[model samples]
Target: MSAKKEEQTAAPAFNLEKAMMDYSGDKYELIVMASILAAQKGKNEEFRFQPRDKVIKASLAEYLAGKITREQLVETYMSERKLMEEKQAQEEKRLEQKAAAPRLELKLSGESL
Candidate 1:
């Protein structure tokens, strides 16, 4: 086995590019806890699991409702982002279909058909 092949087959590094982990002493060390969990769970080669600001806000709703724990924030963000991406894909496909379809002209009541 070549070292280069082994290196290529190795697992991708976890990337969490955010300052959320910097703050402490508030909310029971939840930020650090969530950061750790996100790093552990969000392992992918294509992209890092970066929750958008909106995703963070949306997850806060779930947190407030007691539906999700603080540590689940990143996980919740992933779920919401995936669902949003799916909806966006569907909408884009629909628009393409609409654009491809032929349009019909409708005559006004007072105009000739």
Candidate 2:
């Protein structure tokens, strides 16, 4: 077998441009890619799961390459961001309510409001 044929039989090299082109027509997949990009940017160096970002990026590329649809990628990342935002908002509201609550203190026997 020729060296070129052997190389071809080897795993294909990763191609980001092709992946992006593939998913360019998909709005949801684009959104998912954006979110994954965001998450990767926000990841801390101390964390062990940072490698997942690469996986997500690869998946995005694969999806863009027509190996997967926008819906599939969207279902995971889009919903996760939505749910996280909602939970964050709820927590913020709860904290605000707690902060806004009136404080009461016990007075001495002779004290009165």
Across residues 27-89, which tens digit of lDDT does each residue of candidate 1 receive? 455544444444434454322455544344433333444555664656766887799899999
lDDT of each residue in 1-113, candidate 2, tens digit only: 99999998999987877656654366774756655644544455643355666655655565556665546555766787899999999999999999999989778897976
* Candidate 2 accuracy as TM-score: 0.45
Model 1: number of clashes?
0
The superposed Cα distance between candidate 1 and the true structure at residue 42, in angstroms, equals 25
lDDT of 2 at 69: 54
For lDDT, the strongest prediction is 2
Q: Could you tell me every candidate's TM-score relative to the true structure?
A: 0.35, 0.45
RMSD of 1: 15.0
Candidate closest to the true structure, highest TM-score = 2
lDDT of each: 0.56, 0.66
Question: What lDDT does model 1 reach?
Answer: 0.56
